[model samples]
Target: MMQLDDETLNAYLDGELDPVVRADVEAALARDAEARARLEALRRVSLLGRTAVDELSRLSVDESLQERVWPLPKPEPDCPAARTGRAMTILSGALVLLLGMGLGAWLFPSSPRLAGEAAAVATAWPRQAAWFHHLAAERRTHARPLVLDVEGSEPARLQVELNRTLQQRVVVPDLSDLGLRPLGARLLVEQARPLAQIFYQDAGGNLVSLLVALDSGPDTRPRFERVDDGPATAQWRRANTRYVLVGEPERVRLQDLVPVVAERTTR
Candidate 1:
């Protein structure tokens, strides 16, 4: 077994290592309790940093900093540069948005109290969704065989298959306007909860993913947030499930699609 230092472990946790090194680190983590514990400690710190970033975003909405953190701007009727810039920004940010944690939910448990649980869910779900998205995208990009018992453009067909396997109603969003068509779904377990990852592809050939999981906590009002998971991800919660949309790195574009996705899936 290769021994990993704190710096290597931290880099592994933050997804700073290259793919080959990362795979080795993962293998090490699986066999090392001490490494896992250290990784968990690092995770707590990362979560704290995310919380601080969230709070800072809330506070800086009226300050100059807001423009830098979130540079979303509406385009004038004739100005194409704003729209082009927005697209470029989202794509560029996607590299930074990649979620660093691997098998996040499976590795990290939620807090016990409702508040703590909710906060944990809030902080973790988006990243988890992002991580799933990256996996799905890689499969698509590499032309890897996706083991789907039911695969098609029809949402109903996919839903029936999902229902049969998951024993839960899976909502399929109509994202045709966004040029994404439903391809299929696969079942997964994360943090001991059922997850339905629905795959789609746009006319432009970009892979899009919608991840649905039962709302484990109270029925809080729907909330939206942008998270970095190697790509720009838009996540929102509905009455019964959490929906995360992962696509090419365009934060503004992702945000614009969130409402359409949220409305369709819930309905």
Candidate 2:
């Protein structure tokens, strides 16, 4: 009776769920053979990857060194010229690494061009869903205070497929922190319209697909639908943007995450 939903299951996996929910899920997994098997498989893969990384790290060190954890001894300073050059090389490498990390962090967050594209979609997000469709866009980020808040689709991952699906990359990797994974992504382009789509799912495999299509017409009609025939529900808003989420029956649960996501995204 206490089946874990996608959000809760993902939280459990990520060690973020509360004690009550965690205990409930634990009991449910104990009784649900299929769920237990899946969890075991996930854990095995995760542990195997970590073990391999540890082995590689060990291999990086010299095998003959007895004091692997600390310096055993330093050779005499007979080779001053070589030592100075080595010090300079080490310093240069460290500087380069620090610079690379900083640059990577900046570049990883919403690229500037992507921000403009997302903004166009944000304008329409408010009009898509009946719930919170009334929420207006506002300045949120430190750099772009003009960022608007709109509820449409869950922000997840973007898959850029070149040659119509031959190559791809996961654009939004941060959703892993939110107990979600990338389902799929695509860009919607038309003679008069341009839009972006990102999809996400939790551990229980419930998916939310977001469609951000540019408002081609002067006015666009936003709609919401809960499909009885399918495992998905969709909502759209027509402001200066459009957003949609499609998923299994767990979509009702996903609705609860929207306000939480909106609060964080807008803050």
Candidate 3:
């Protein structure tokens, strides 16, 4: 019998376990309902991530997105556009590096110099997601009503309601299967891109938000990296949609919802 820890279990789910270890995990799952549930959740998250990444790989780089994130100065006839363009390109690259480092610092406040792989994962969007989550959480905390339910209770109903409000097809995950209930839906915008955020509360009164957006890039998916910044966020992508699960860092409970999200947001 192999004792399962977070690392081992994640490795098993990711198919990184060797034959003997994999068999041990399977045996453990045969007798442990909790282990089985966790395994299912990891599978869902992994599949959703891979799907998003594969789809993104097939598409070309979005020029509009490039302009939005890294704007280049306009060319002038009097000056050499090529020279200016090259200089601007170098400047833009430096900006991206500085931005990543800034985000890394914000994410790992105690350890600003994130090393190797973690440094690579420290990018712009997670920082933005964490910041947005912090703002929203603070607002909810200070408000008289800690949580509010503005519309439907179920996923389908909520999706319809949110679509009406957003004027777009917003996929709402049915988290009832995981003992989570929808509190309501809200809209937030970033860089003129509207995002649909669905709120859920567990029996323990823990709040989690699913922030969904229709914009993504080629490098977008198949990864559920945890952000330990202001909020413990589990981020992944599906096609053009990017989803972030925002929860309190103290809670550290959003990972369990990854599978539920992966399954329910298939549409």
Candidate 2, pairs of clashing residues: 123-240, 123-241, 124-241, 127-237, 128-236, 128-237, 137-148, 137-149, 139-145
Q: Ten-residue segment with the worst summed lDDT in candidate 2?
A: 132-141
lDDT of each: 0.63, 0.44, 0.63
Candidate 1 structure lDDT: 0.63
Over the stretch 1-267, how does candidate 2's per-residue lDDT look in tens digits?
887565566678779988987898999988888887777766677799887975564443463463454222332232669668867975774466457556553343233332222232222232232111111111111121221222124442222331122222213334566676654445434333444455555776444555444332233222234332333333433333334544443334544444343333223
Kindly report which residue pairs in candidate 3 clash with one another: 49-222
lDDT of 1 at 232: 55
Q: How big is the RMSD of model 1? A: 21.3
How many residue pairs clash in all the candidates, one count each?
9, 9, 1
Q: What is the lDDT of residue 43 in candidate 3?
A: 82
Clashing pairs in 1: 90-249, 90-250, 91-249, 97-228, 97-229, 97-230, 98-229, 98-230, 99-229
| lDDT score for residue 171 of model 2 | 30
